[model samples]
Target: DGPLARLRDRNQLDRADKARNFALAQAGEKYRECFFRAGLDPLRTLDPSQEVKSAFSPNGLWRCESQIENLQKFRAAREAIPEDFREPLAAIVLEDREIVDVGREIGAYKDAKMAGAVALFILRRGLTALARHYRLISPTGAV
Candidate 1:
């Protein structure tokens, strides 16, 4: 694969793995929030799409998506609620938000978790941006 293609594959893999990770994390966060209402330090962990990443299954996010597909029951629920109610969508938006944040944060921080679009985007914008900078400074100049 070309560098971009490899990056895309890894990032897509990471996104898929992260979908699973974020689902479980948010679920645990939800359970934990029930008691303390979301403290400062959220948990962090690696992705789980590799051959031997972990023994435990990573299916919670898929399950969560399946569970949430029942929102058809609320097709009219939005009309019933008052205008002051905060939430607008029936689904969690973290995925897209993180995707967009990837472009933004990577442009700024150069290596931050917030960059989460295509796998290549993550490679350039998230963990590898600093390395990219150094590589650019080397003989290649980002060829």
Candidate 2:
């Protein structure tokens, strides 16, 4: 399961309203979509045949129009997030990393519990901002 699913299972999202939950899910899906479209997934491996050079694009560094648009959208969504919240959001949403790992990486908490809590909070706020940027949620309501 993903971080969001784990959060829901643990009732961490109990305080969030339906709209906020939907917005968060939408933001996450969009982020993942853009991430894959932009060819930024580190885990994806290209086949040898796919890697072979062709006459059309010898360097194999070509992007379709849709990909270009998604890349722009990805940049816009990323920029919409606050600097403090960006890393955690990307860790959980894009890389599927655990919140505790993210917390440990940030290194500001005295305990693991506190670190996870802070990381979760940062991720939620970042997702909210992204939802607003994508118009999945309103700026002033239910965020």
Candidate 3:
């Protein structure tokens, strides 16, 4: 059997012995557990054929894919909003503006909660419009 298969067997044995104590609920914890279960080998590659010293590791590939997905989501979000509203929302996200500050900038709402609600409503509407534009959703709002 391969090293990975052996490791998997060992992990399963350990888990059986531990009665699920090794299991984690959170995603980050689960990833860490996977690494630990793999015996914490720095030189190990998911693809055994790849060199241990390869610049593009499995983690790097996963990160690259995650970044692309995030960029796509950002683009979709930007395209959803009006041109004028873009700058303000960008400032809120990038500059870490406070709820009160956002409220002040967005006018007509005295309450911070109300302002936040309004912003959320706008964001939802924009996303829905974008969904319609992409034809992922129908006019009756069936996705």
lDDT, each prediction: 0.29, 0.73, 0.41
Clashes of 1: 3
After superposition on all CA atoms, what RMSD does each candidate show versus the true structure? Answer: 19.2, 5.2, 17.8
Candidate number achieving the greatest lDDT relative to the actual structure: 2
lDDT of 1 at 28: 22
Off by over 4 Å in 2: 8-14, 43-57
- The local distance difference test score of model 1 is 0.29
Q: Taking the tens digit of each residue's C-alpha lDDT, what string does model 2 give over 48-117? A: 2244235324566545777557767887888899988877888888778888889878868868898888
lDDT at position 16, candidate 2? 49
Ranking by lDDT: 2, 3, 1
* Candidate 3: segments with Cα more than 4 A from true spot: 1-80, 88-101
Pairwise lDDT winner, candidates 1 and 2: 2
Model 1 lDDT per residue over 11-79, tens place = 442355544333323322232232122111122132211222233236423224332332222222223
**Residue 61 displacement (Å), model 1:** 37
lDDT of 3 by residue, 1-143 (tens): 42212323445312443322122111113222333343323343342223233354554443444534544554554565566555444333333354345655676887887876565444334434544544545656554
Cα TM-score per model? 0.17, 0.79, 0.34
